[model samples]
Target: MFQNPSNEAIASILKNAKTIAVVGLSDDPSRESYAVSAEMQRRGYKIIPVNPNVQEVLGERAVASLADLPEPVDIVNIFRRSEALPDVVREAVNTSAPVIWAQQGIYNEEAADIARAHGKTMVMDRCIMVMHSLFVRGA
Candidate 1:
């Protein structure tokens, strides 16, 4: 099993992260991923939506995959099931993103291992918005 990141580490990641590639982000606002990524954008972080099916999200052009991102990224925020993380990790490694964040209720030790192997910070089963609120915005 993968342990969640420490509060301090999460706070640091949220503090420094400026570009977040949100994988599996849906167009529907009802989805947790959409809501969280949108909030991140509201905080001035650039949100790159990574969903093959979506052309755009939050007024930004969406990339089909992490590998398709035009610029280097600070964080790869994953919203898929645990079963999908391994592939996402592989793709994220290609970008050399500093952090791999699996949203609340999602965890994959295999993907975490892959991220750690590449020296990327791995956070599982935590909501980025919640962490940012508690740490940066101090809600």
Candidate 2:
């Protein structure tokens, strides 16, 4: 089992990443993806919604996959289940995203190892919104 990233590292990653591709993001605000993406956007990172089911989310145009994004994304924030993590992590690593963040309750050691081996930072089962607050600090 992989432990979640330290607060300092998570804060630094969130602070430096300007563009976040939120995989599995939903249109519903009650959803975890929606809440995290909303907070990321509020904190000034461009939130790119990646979900085939939604055409748009959080007032921004949504892409079906990270591969479909217009340009390179700094972070690939995954909101999918453990079973769906492999493909998303593969795509994220292939895209050369600097960071791959698996949301709370989601974990895949194989996928995380693959990402890390590819020189990408992997943060599993951590909330980006919480980390963002640590970095932004009183903002």
Candidate 3:
């Protein structure tokens, strides 16, 4: 079961993060991943697209996997299904990222355990764009 994430923690992650590795980020403008990432980019966050199927997204080079990122990302924003999160979390544990966020309607306790064990701030079942609008600014 997933407990609610702390507002302060979510706020801290959003407030401090700059480069975000959007795993499963879609190039389609209609997708939530695209909309969320676009808004974040518009807010000045460097959006790193981590989709293997696409060469690039939103003008940024898309990496195939978390290990392919050229540098460490401040946040790993995943749009994959809850069942797929364990694999992504396993990959993310190898990185030095400070935060790992699963978009709304996605959460896996086991995966969250892995992230928490690795000292990452796990924010699940919450929309980053909504949180940013409500907590960070322009609410």
Off by over 4 Å in 2: 1-3
Candidate 3: C-alpha lDDT: 0.90
Evaluated at residue 48, the lDDT of candidate 1 is 90
Ranking by lDDT: 3, 1, 2
**Cα lDDT, all candidates:** 0.89, 0.85, 0.90
Among these predicted structures, which one has the highest lDDT? 3
Evaluate residue 71 in candidate 1 and report its C-alpha lDDT on the 0 to 100 scale.
85
| Residue 17 displacement in candidate 2 (angstroms) | 1.0
Each model's TM-score, in the order given?
A: 0.95, 0.91, 0.95
Mark the 10 consecutive residues where model 2 has the least summed lDDT.
130-139
For model 2, residues 48-121, the per-residue Cα lDDT tens digits are 89999999998889999888998788899999999899888999987857889998888998997888789888
Error of 2 at 22 (Å): 0.3
